[model samples]
Target: MALVIGVVSQKGGVGKSTLARLIACNYAASEWRVKIADMDLAQGTCTSWNRRRLQNEIEPKVAVEQFLNVDDAIKTGEQYDLVVFDGAPHSTRKTLDIADACDLLILPTGVSLDDLEPTIKLAHELKKHGIYPPKISIALTRAGNSDVELAEGMEYVRSSGYHLLDGVIHEKTAIRRASDEGKCATETSFKSINEKVDQLVQAIVNRADELGKK
Candidate 1:
């Protein structure tokens, strides 16, 4: 059985697509058959990205396809070890439907109240709709300064009664630049940022492996 991971958020530019691609590329590199379902049919961000990734002939090749329906997307999971879903930034029924189907849901957001505010609301909505608390987590991406600040952000997320991912994607131009060229954050220029990406990937993949056995 495949582990279906959904990278979702109600706010735009929160690095949801980037997170999805990171997961696919990491698993594919590790030789764990991977495929990405670009559920944001309107934007097709992951679809276009996969096209560039192929054109550039990037190593550890992974595949991606776009689908409008969650059921159709879910069907693709049977073919790979992992299926990463990059969903739209909307509070529509489709978003919740995607959340309902995933084995794990990753909500990427920045550190401040502006980013955390809407995310908090969405967290409540997911819980209200019966999304298992352990299956959902808030990943702090594009975070601000220092380990201290990141620790504070973690505390804030915990205080809000939501689980926080262990890895933080700091604000780094190297990450975005690599994405433009069809490269994963792990392949970016900064070793520090790359390490962060790797750590998060490890945590998420471990969870998938743990759940897949059940």
Candidate 2:
């Protein structure tokens, strides 16, 4: 069976789709057959991004499709090595479905209380619905260049008694530009930015592996 990963959020513009595409493309580049299930049907974010990627003829060729239901995505996912669900913004019944379906559920948020509060609350909701705490992770994204704020954000997640991923994806114009060109954060033109994103990616991979063993 394919390893399923979900990128979900309490609200939009919090790097949810960004993390989904990043994970899909990195696994695909490593020669793994990867599929991104774009659960945000109204937005079709990953679906449109894949179209641009194909047009650009980017390597490894990640497959992306919009699915109205989690069951259908899981059924289709069995054919690939990995399936990444780019879930819709805001909590819905489907959010719990994704939480139940995925081996790893990643919640990406910014440094502010606005983002952090809802992200942790969603995590709590998932737990209330019987989702394992270790199976869920919090990733800091679109962070400003303030070390102190980043550290505080990390502490907030940790203090909430949830696992926090090691690295932060600092807000960068280059990353946005790469996405506009159908590229992931790890595929940016700047080597430094690519490396920084890779740290978070590696942490994600490691967390998934650790969870799989349990």
Candidate 3:
């Protein structure tokens, strides 16, 4: 069976799809057959992005498909090594289903209270629904260059009693441009930005591996 990872958020513009694409691309680059199940039917963000990626003929091709339900995605994903669920921006009954199905669930948020509060709340909700705390992680995304603010955000996530991924996805014009061109954060032209994204990806991989052993 393919290892399933879910990227979900309480609201939009929190980098949920970005993280999904990042994981899918990285795993595909490593020669793993990966598929991104774009569950956000309204936006279809990853679906359109994959179109651009194919048009650009990017290497390490990643498959992306829109699925109305998680079970179908999991069934299709059995042929691949990994399946990444890019869930809807807001929580619904389906959110718990995704949490139940994933080996690792990532919640991406900004540094502000606006983002942090909802992200943490969603984690608590999942826990209430019987999701294991260790399988749920918080990733800081679309963050600015303020070290103090970043530190506070990290502390906030830790204080909430969830695992906080080690690196941040710093907001950069290059990353946005790369996304516009159907590239992920790590595929930007700037090597420094790529390194930062890679750090977070590594942390994600390590966390998933650690949990798989238990």
- The whole-model lDDT of each prediction reads 0.84, 0.92, 0.92
| Positional deviation of residue 71's Cα in model 1 after best superposition, in angstroms | 0.5
The predictions' CA RMSDs to the true structure, in order, are 1.6, 1.1, 1.1
User: Which digits, one per residue and each the tens of the lDDT, describe model 3 over residues 1-214?
Assistant: 8999999987999999999999999989989999999999999999999999999998789999999989999999989999999999765777888999999999999999999999999999899989998999999998988999999999999999999999889889998898888999999999998998999999998998998731
Model 2, CA-based lDDT: 0.92
Candidate 2, which segments miss by more than 4 Å at Cα? none
lDDT score, candidate 1, position 136? 83
Candidate 2 local lDDT, 1-214, one digit each (tens): 9999999996999999999999999999888999999999889998888888889988879999999899999999989999999999865798999999999999999999999999999999999999988999999999998899988898899999999998889999999999998999999999999999999999999999998731
TM-score to true structure, per model:
0.93, 0.98, 0.98
- How many backbone clashes can be found in candidate 2? 0
Which whole-number lDDT from 0 to 100 does residue 108 have in model 1? 91
Q: Model 3 off-target regions past 4 Å?
A: none
Error of 1 at 133 (Å): 1.3
Mark the 10 consecutive residues where model 3 has the least summed lDDT.
Answer: 205-214
Better of 1 and 2 by TM-score: 2
- Which residue pairs collide in model 3, if any? none
Model 1 lDDT per residue over 130-190, tens place: 8887778888998877878778778888999876777878878899889888998898977
